[model samples]
Target: MPRFAANLSMMYTEHDFLDRFAAAAKDGFQAVEYLFPYDHPAAEIRKRLDDNGLTQALFNAPPGDWGAGERGIAALPGRETEFRTEFAKALEYAAVLGNDRVHVMAGIVPADADHARCRSIYLENLAYASASAASHGITVLIEPINTRDMPGYFLNRQDEGQTICRQVGAANLKVQFDCYHCQIVEGDIAKKLERDFAGIGHIQIAGVPERHEPDIGELNYPYLFDVIDRLGYTGWIGCEYRPRGGTSEGLGWIKPWLKR
Candidate 1:
């Protein structure tokens, strides 16, 4: 059976961000991941994790000005300096927090921008991050977010992500396979997982169309879990979903999964 990690950013919205660590542990999660952690001090977060006996599985690097609609700066034309600075900051946090994986968002592609130029910048930036993160024993991750939720997003396909990983030629870089976005962009969930299992570092799941709990999704998570085990994936499967009701109340699916 796969070890599961709660996505505190979306899973435990009922409590304050700092308190979610305890909430997740009380609810039976052994690990946790979130979108960003720049707001609070890393030491504080680390203490919470230690207090709860929870491991920090993953978290995203700083995406520029999230409130202003800038998802990430990595693929942006002239923001290479900012992108590297943000990644270094995240690496600092990860070192103190003992987090090993960090996702680097590829930013949105401008409608009128040159595609080749953007791809070039993205690859170089990833290579830089991969080298820097490797020195600290941290791995860099790239995810293919669906365009529906994030229109114009630079990376939007699994194959493209895999290709980028290969082209970057960094052993520390891998794909963050999000099932919700994968189903939206390409429907073959099991086959895709099987094909890319070697390059995949992390996995996230949610209901199709609604982005809710896995138990209420169009995807058959139970069968997919079987596939994950049969394929020999040993990483954490992140529960990156909004609960249909109270976060704890909708976790009936987890108990049965743990028993396996």
Candidate 2:
């Protein structure tokens, strides 16, 4: 059976980190993942991880000011220095949190920015981070956000994500397999999983149309889970979705999968 983890960022705020941590543990999750850890003190986060006996399976690198029109700089040219500083900051937090993976958030690039240039910058940044984080036993993950939901994002396709991972040529670099985004952009979830399982470092799920629980949508999670089981994945599958009601209330649909 695969371990399950809740992504607290989508379900809880920075103020509710501890509360959610305890909740996830009580609810029977073996671990937890989140978007970013910059808001809380690294030591405090580490302490909580120990307190609840929850593993920090995944966390995201710095995504620049979303309010300032910058989502990330991993694929931007002028933001190379910005990416380094932000990544280093994320690395510090990841080390303290004992997180195994640092997901690279693919931000939106301006319409005028050259795609080749963006790819170049991203590769450079990946090379730099891969070398630095490898010493600490951390893998850098690349997530492809669906363009329909995240317009102008640099990487949106599984193929493109794989391409970038290869271009970086770092053993530490891998793709975050987000079921929600991939279902929206490309529907062959099982085939893609089979084809790229080796390069996929993490997985997340949310129902299509509502971004709610799997039982409430078009995706047949029972079959999906079976496929995952057959693939023999040992990593955690993050419940990264919005609840129709209270976070705990929305978890009823996934109670069965949690058993596995």
Candidate 3:
């Protein structure tokens, strides 16, 4: 079975962020990931990880001013300096947490911005972030988020993400394949997994339409899990979903997988 990581940012929300580490462990998760960890001190987060015997699987670099509707700055024109600064800060947290992967949000595109300009900026920022992350032995992940959830998200397709990864040409740069987004943006989840497994660095999953637990999704996670195992993907699969009910109560889908 593929190793699973509870997304502390989405899962275990009943508890405080600092307490989610232990909550995940108590609920039988061996590892955890989150959207961002900058809100807490590195030492505090590390202490929770140590206390709970959990591994930090992944987390995203800061997306600029999240409250102000800026999902990220990587692809934004003239924000290269801010993007790089956030990446360096993420690295500091990773060093303390011993996490090896960081997702680089590509930011929302401006209505008046040229697509070519946005793509160029995105690629340039990826190259810079990937090269810098490689020095710390960390991999940079670019995910294809569905535009439905994030209306203006710049990176919203697997092919686009693959192209960006290729242009960056950094060994540490890879795709963060979110099954939920892929299913919405493009179907053929199993085929995509098999075809692009080589380029993928991390994976995330949630139910279709509602973005809830995988058990009720349009995709059959059991067969897909078997497919992933057969395809030899040894990386962590992040459970990035909102619980339909209480987080712990909704973990029935994961119990069987964890038993494997």
Give the TM-score of each candidate: 0.99, 0.95, 0.98
Better of 1 and 2 by lDDT: 1
Task: Write the candidate numbers in order of decreasing TM-score.
Answer: 1, 3, 2
Q: Which window of 10 residues has the lowest lDDT sum in candidate 2?
A: 10-19
Please give, for residues 212-259, the per-residue lDDT of candidate 3 as tens digits: 999996989989999999989898999999999999999998888888
Which runs of model 3 end up more than 4 angstroms from their true locations? none
- Candidate 1 residues 1-260, lDDT tens each? 98999999999899999999999999999999999999999999999999999999999999999999999988998999999899999999999889899999999888999989999999999999999999999889999999999999999999999999999999999999999999999889999999999999899999888999898868999999999999998889999999988999999988998887
Q: What is the C-alpha lDDT of each candidate?
A: 0.94, 0.85, 0.92
Worst lDDT 10-window in candidate 1:
209-218
> Quick one: best lDDT, which candidate?
1
Q: Which of the predicted structures, 2 or 3, would earn the higher lDDT when compared with the native?
A: 3
Query: Model 3, clash count?
Result: 0
- lDDT of candidate 1 vs native? 0.94
Error of 3 at 116 (Å): 0.6
Report how far off residue 179 is in candidate 2 (Å). 0.5
If the candidates were sorted by their lDDT against the true structure, best first, what order would they fall in?
A: 1, 3, 2
Better of 1 and 3 by lDDT: 1
Scored by lDDT, model 3 comes in at 0.92
The residue pairs in collision within model 1 are none
